[model samples]
Target: MSRPRRFLPSVSLLTAFEAVLRTGSTAAAARELDLTQGAVSRLVQNLESQLGQPLFLRERRRLIPTEAARAYGRDISRALDLVARASMELAANPGGGVLSLAILPAFGTRWLAPRLAGFLSAHPGITINLATRLKRFNFAAEGFDAAIHFGVDDWRGAGHLRLFDETLVACAAPAFLRANPIRQPADVHALPLLQIETRPTAWPEWFRAHGLVAPLPRGMLFDQFAPMTQAAIHGLGVALLPEFLAMPDLDEGRLQRLPGAPVSGTGSYWLVWPEARADYPPVVALRDWLAAETADLRAREGAGDGADDGDRTRTP
Candidate 1:
């Protein structure tokens, strides 16, 4: 069904009204829209006449938007931004093989970025645009073709491709570990434990996995793993980092593994796409590539090998 004509005003009228609402005056809106002040005023007046409602209050030659108009302007602004982004994407990729993918910060930089070259080389015609999304988002609203999701396979209305399970290693700066040595599994609780905002239960689950049952202490909170890993390297606190993320630091001797075995994290990683794009060429290519890429790791995990080995190497 088509939208009511009155509710769906012309883009020009909406742009003019939005500009006036944003710029505070017809003169400023005129400057922004590259129209005469009189023309801009006429546009807003025309919109008001079409809608049969007053959008602005004329007070001493000043235009003050009504509350309803302000609210409407906010929605219009978002819509305009979405339209502009879509336009730009189309302009940039006229041939139409653009894949806008959202990724986790650490995983994208440490894991996927290094391996993207092979995918790009194989599919030279496809362009992959990556954006960092630390948490779940609406695919339709966000305008993403797919996203790297780190959790259980529970994203509603989306298709999932298993990547790999995450293994967490408790690590700290070498100096900090020397100063506060960890001799047992319970010793981790005695020290300041860094926390990731998204994984609030990580420390507790790690402790539980090691057969330790104690209330965890509050410590430094970080929104992402990159900074938390840096904080741990700087002797701020002991952090439970993903094995893939902590491997370089441990290998370079910047951080030492705390006295414990690597524990399985709460969830696994997945490549998720909306159901509508289930057959999208780029999504299918990426899904197949990821499945093939992580086949060995997934097999190892399935076979239950190295369940408690801290020295085992794992790739993301």
Candidate 2:
């Protein structure tokens, strides 16, 4: 199953070629690699000899990479990054397993972070590293073992495990609500409305669920829920927030639920991994742990416990 010897370039040759292509000169590549200019030029020449083609076009004193060489450099750069990441991980965790997970910011901080200790306690040999990623990414290029996805199960070539559906509550600061009382669902439009960037149609959808269908006024737009939640706490505007995110603030009297029933958001939470990593040991362990952790929420959702009287029947 090994590739032909000619197809596999040495790391030194690849590094030199990639550096020259990226830096646009052998002098710059030499500075980066801490090698003399002549040494770097030699490495490039050796690589070209091995490949049986000229990768660069010499004009005056400049070296311009050919179009084909530019494309090949892109692949080489990715391969080098992968190798570096692997080397770093191996050095950091020597004998232990490492799982690099991409997570949604609010969900990671409010939900998963609190319960992660239990998972780590159960599997002491596994180390989980988390990074915030708000949108989908190329798994092969990013080098993540798994990601926390908040949407429909539509990640092609990835295996999904349902976590839980989110229930959204329209809420505002207690002072703001007292200042502009919400007597009905339509009253929400009278005040400033905050919107999360990820959920563009949330306000419209929430209004439609309450039998009030019309174009909504644009308000402040936030990229993440954390800042939006804080803005609502400071009486900036009413925000549609997930119940889990809003519960603590509501209980502490920082925010008050608007005069409307809770409605299901347009998406559900999921633990997704590339199909190639479906059976990875760390991934499998985390999947099993998440399934157990979300069992209660799943049960409540199935029994209609998470729904309200008004929009309980609507699917997420």
TM-score of each: 0.84, 0.90
| lDDT tens readout by residue for model 2, 1-316 | 8898788989999999999999999999999999999999999999999999999999998999999999999999999998998898888887767899999999999999999999999999888999999999999889999999998777878887778888999999988888998899998877888998899888888999999874566679999999999999999999999999888899999999998899989988888888878888999999999988988888888846333211111112
Q: What is the lDDT of residue 290 in candidate 1?
A: 83
In model 2, where do residues sit more than 4 Å from their true spots?
A: 303-316
198: Cα error in model 2, Å = 1.8
Q: Highest TM-score: which candidate? A: 2
TM-score of 2: 0.90
* Positional deviation of residue 45's Cα in model 1 after best superposition, in angstroms: 3.0
